[model samples]
Target: MTGEPILEVRGLCVDYGLGEQAVRAVTDATLTLHRGEVLGLAGESGSGKSTLAYALTRLLRAPGVITGGEVRFHGRDGSLDLLDADAAALRRVRWSRISVVFQSAMHALNPVARIDAQLTDALRAHRPELSAAQRTERAAELLRMVGISADRLRSHPHELSGGMRQRVMIAMALALDPEIVIMDEPTTALDVVTQREILTELMRLKDELGFAVVFITHDLSLLVELADTIAIMYAGRLVERGPARALFERPLHPYTAGLLDSFPPLHGARVRMEGIPGSPPALTALPPGCAFHPRCPSARERCRVDQPPTAAPAPAPAAATAAPAAADGERTAACWLIDADRETPARPARTPGSTP
Candidate 1:
């Protein structure tokens, strides 16, 4: 089980440029991650999930800038604000306290360098006291930890399979035993079998090492199986967040429900599934009030003019026989349809999809 807040983000905002040409990519996003927990961030392609992860780690590029909000890292020593941290402090925190496994392993890894060299580079930089032999031994051990044979240490990126390359990236991230691992679709382009193998290995490693994870992906089904808590993003705003089962079985937000319906169930009777109608609004020309109102099936007159604040969802009906309900204050959704005075639209019963 997870325990204690290790990371906290509040009102985080990110923009692509400056002045009149600036385009907001992320707005007023807030979430907390606990030690040994897996917090899944799920959204469509351009929903700013990657941007949020980059901003949290201070890895965003020049075109993208963090305009507001704070990220606090609670360490064994003390709490430090990531946004206000200086270069020296950030260096100390990055690999030692937090690490990242980027989206594309082939792009992230050096095509020309041997796997051993790539793995040991961080150790050499962070732990200069260790001798060359000691670093080599550590690198070999990292490979074995990720289920790769130590003999493959001499192999270059082009020599290994796609799955192996991704595993190497995971090994490198864990080189310093960081407390948090931010994975931005680490399993994106791999085959189904390979994805399952990697995910199983990752879960095992997380259990053994006790590291928290911020898993960002567009695969909601995969996250429903892997995540302890799931946060839904739409048009750069957090629309809903709750326990994985709770969110899957009873999503309070229309966008969350639409996402669940987009995937087909693995078992039982076959049924038609409809994708969310209409495209996401452009950040440069977003609709007024709620950004999702244009496509929301449950949209009301009030929803078109007033933005809904994130608040606790109303209790489920007694007849609902799904996952256990989250405790009060533990579940939140940003939709006017979930308001106490309003009647929530009845969701048609449908089977949930299984992980591919």
Candidate 2:
């Protein structure tokens, strides 16, 4: 369903400050987003989900720096290294090629400005060829595309409902018809029903527009339904990446299993759930080996002393069938437990209720 690679991130590292005092917020984070696919980035609060998003987009503010990484954005024209792209190149690509719908629409939108003016701002900047009347017409069309009345385009952000404002933000992001849209918790502030509406609208729009999405959220359950691919991050590092259904029904990493357990199933019998035991490690004072060792239920001595490299996990046994296992080379996990299990074929990988 997904097309060719559109955005590729490799060995991306982000720091919060200068050397000696710096906190590594994201370390060696890597993922590829294919055209027209929805890649969900999920983790608990302060897990670097947003940091990775901003860093890759070159939107990280002062005091936060991209210490290391390569962000290659492949457009229809050609490929460009986003991490090294100059201001002019970035401007040419931002709205017209890659757009961002930030976390909260209420805060992202200008409270004083009318929706039409705000929507047309990007068109004015990136699309100067359009006349004043043309830009206004396009703005009105965008509002209607997102299901908001064109008349509401004259309304101010404060005058609109939260859901309406969020829709307007989405409209602005789509105004230029960008190839990629990065949404950071776009529905976090809306009510459950409204959230579903917005998400359904988003998917429908994606189907019609064919733009790739990097959706960042802490809600694993939501991602399960919305994303084609899911990437799980813990302590600033990606712990797992695979097909959404595979990750949801048969999480290969203990951390992933813990996250899935935290959310009760919608159709299954109720069962007591024990979430991950401890807090995430401080970025400035991470443990010696794996940052997750302190909290991983299946952590071993080696896990406390030796960091595990990210690698493709061994294929699931033929008899195992909770969900379809990710094909070879299609799934990867960072966990010493996976390595241990691979070494001993007789030993089964630990699951949610299995003895660790």
TM-score of each predicted structure versus truth:
0.95, 0.94
Q: What is the C-alpha RMSD of each candidate to the true structure, in Å?
A: 1.8, 3.9
Question: How displaced is residue 25 in candidate 1, in Å?
Answer: 0.7
lDDT of 2: 0.86
| Residue 236's lDDT in candidate 2 | 94
Per-candidate Cα lDDT values, in order, are 0.89, 0.86
Model 1 clash number: 0
lDDT per residue for candidate 1 within 229-334, as digits (tens), equals 9999999999999888778777788898888887877766776777688989999988888999998877888889998899986676546536554433388888
Residue pairs in clash, model 1: none
Runs of candidate 1 with Cα error greater than 4 angstroms are 327-329, 340-353
